[model samples]
Target: MEGIEEKLVVSTADVLDYHSILEAVKDCCALFCCLDSQDGYEDKMVDLEVRGAINVVEACAQTESMEKIVFNSSLTAAIWRENICSQKDVDERSWSDQEFCRKKKLWYALAKTLSEQAAWALAMDRTLNMVSINAGLVLGPAVAKKNPLVTMSYLQGAAQMYENGVLAIVDVNFVADVNVRAFEDRSSCGRYFCFDQMVNTEQEAVKLAESLSPLISLPPRYECQGSEVYAERLRNKKLNKLVEGTAC
Candidate 1:
């Protein structure tokens, strides 16, 4: 409990030193989370997330105080399909195929799938209590105060599929609230897909954006044939049940 008094947040670069991690969590519980970006580091982002989790787990095992580990995965990992609109329902069992990701150059989707897969593998192998929240396109005000435009840029549009006719949308606050709930609710295991609304095409996104705020201009429409990475027979009953009473 000596060194755990201070809270430290490390990025991918700082994780290179395993000793630093062990030292930091030597006396207290540790929680590991990652919010990876899709830009650059396409080949290594998955490995980075895996290694990051390993570092945290190893540290926790040594300390015997690591309470939980949470990962912020994306709904893109679940909704990469040619026809999500036709889907009666979707859930955690769904996965985006790497081949389709390669074809569409969907680096963000690839990052989520690879990272979550790595995390799942590690969690099972190490017997770690791990939970992941698969989130949709996060929309809200900017966290950093740097520039409003930078924040607005991300909120302005939907994914290519959403513009074309796929994927869904979730409020940033809802995603945050769910992440917190997952940590507090011991029953929260496996993966939870968090989204406020589902948008089939880019035009739909534009319409919704216009309704939300007249100032925002919708992006141009684009054609995107979704991928069928997983069989449509997968089940998401648990997630649907959870969403039944909850307000987004």
Candidate 2:
């Protein structure tokens, strides 16, 4: 892959420093935010993922050049500890319970939940045109190679997420496609679940587990066949309609 500097200007910036972020994208028409931090690190997570998110949104709101902002969020902000079996189906409307995330020590989920929530708040308060892509486990080869073990831990959890049917996975390329569509489509509003497929059944989960074992660290081993995973019922008519004819 070519470096970002090859075609685009690359500048050093910090998510925590609001002024720095404002300087980076304030002149742009569209901004795609994919900010995140270490999984279990509370301090870094809050500083970068949470505060950083606010800075980016505020920057968008402050900028006159901004037209659209597409924020890349995780399904973790939508799933986890919500009693998946209780809900008919999980979608963008469903938000992962914050208290539940804390109880389960799902620090990453908590960060994402708070960050996305803050982004929405900023959007509404500023009347900025913003869209969120609540994507599932983003599967890409070596995308997080800097910390493979940590990344693998996330995938290992994916087995349970898939088995429960409330979790989904999307290819990296498809994620970018969805983000672009969300920004370009004038009517694209709110959040779009950017998943290619939902593992709705026990057999499908098992297949995925085996297939992903090579990359996932200590992938989940399912012994029981759960036939009642409401996660399988997740559907995004909005995203489907958005990509009906496009490259996505």
Candidate 3:
């Protein structure tokens, strides 16, 4: 019940009302910040993400029982930027350049990058335990139909990402599992890049297109006949360590 009397000032809103967030997280040991913005409102998405993250982290700061926060973020936050080729390895430490995102009109990437940054800054200032899951384009049953905006936004620079060997995907189930494991395992710290497949080859790209189905258009009777290979630069060593630790 420590810090229970600390009153935080937050803007009024139908959603993300400060009091509501505080009440919901009361006595909770852990928090998962999985936020998304609707596709059409690109202009307001950044503001929404930044504000939502601030409110959530501020609330967690007031809850003494809060042990850790598992923030769900997209790999786009780490992969988009100029001169990606210069970086030998892209990992949790990698961050997308905000200026590049704005210049390219990659609103989703900007939103995630800024929001996650905001959350981390506030969490560190408040001394709250936190970890982030920077996942790739999440794919699962009916993904295109269920999360069209998010899925498409993550793929905005698909060609560049693919060429850089950073275009990747992870199952929705794997993302969920990672979030939970990161929360429960105290050894898990900082950021973990979660992905299962990298779309570097012609065959892999075709498979991704097929998985996204009608959302990603393919030529009539398109077929994948190449086993082309590209060196994948993104790494998930931290995530592997977490999985290994859990299996023990």
Candidate 4:
């Protein structure tokens, strides 16, 4: 891959620092907000996510050059809780129940849901153009090491997610591609669910557990017939519409 500098201008600024973020967004027509907490800092994840989103959206709103903002969110923001199966389908329009998230101590889901909600609220109020990509567990090379916080947080209610058939995965590269598509495609609006596969089978679940080993582990000599596949209720129709006729 080419060096980042060769392809784009990079800047460093704390999301909490409104002035710095405002300055960095200047002269930029589009912005991608992919912010998250680091390892060992999960306790502050909700505060950071909500405030960071507000700050970033406010910055984008203040800039005359800003035309679009692509926000990165999580499928966990929509998949948790017990009654989800009763719904006809889990799609971009669905949102995780905040009370359920709190009851289950799913801070990551709470954080993403609240932050995305905050962003949408401000963007609509300011009449700013924005789109959100609600992605699944992003798996790619060194994902466990590079995105430990998000990965672990996403798996917090693994058994429930698996039982509900909402456990899903998406390639990091695909997520990145979708973000770019969402920003460039004028027709893309609102939220899009971005997942490549569902971990609804014993085989797939085992594979996922194996991949995150050390961070995650399986029983000794574990084996499965790999034939048990759970029903999948999650949908990505909006994402399909956004990428239709385009290379994705």
Output the better candidate (1/3) by lDDT: 3
Candidate 4, residue 146: the lDDT equals 85
**Cα lDDT tens digits for candidate 4, 1-248:** 56766877678889999999998999999999987776623546788889999999999999999989999988988887669877768997789999998888889899999999999999999999999999999999997788787689888989888878899999999999999899888777889899999889999999999898878988888878888888898998778877783322
Higher TM-score: candidate 1 or 4? 4
Candidate order by lDDT, highest to lowest? 4, 3, 2, 1
**What TM-score fits each model?**
0.67, 0.83, 0.90, 0.94
With a 3 Å backbone cut-off (N, CA, C), the pairs that clash in candidate 4 are none
Clashes of each: 11, 2, 0, 0
Backbone clash total, candidate 3: 0
- The parts of candidate 1 lying over 4 Å away from their true place are 1-13, 28-32, 38-46, 81-87, 143-160, 163-166, 201-204, 207-248
* Candidate 2: regions farther than 4 A off: 1-6, 38-44, 144-160, 210-231, 245-248
Q: What is the model-wide C-alpha lDDT for candidate 2?
A: 0.75
Tens digits of per-residue lDDT for model 2, 1-248: 46765777876789889999889985799999987554544534644678888989998899999999999888888877757656676777888888877776677777788899999998999999998998876767655555444455345346557666666777789998888788888888888888898776766666555556565333355475666554465777768887974323
How well does candidate 1 score on lDDT at residue 138? Answer: 62
Name model 4 segments beyond 4 Å from true. 1-7, 40-43, 245-248
Per-residue error for 209 in candidate 3, Å, reads: 0.5
- Model 4 residue 151 CA deviation (Å) reads 0.8
lDDT of 2 at 149: 47
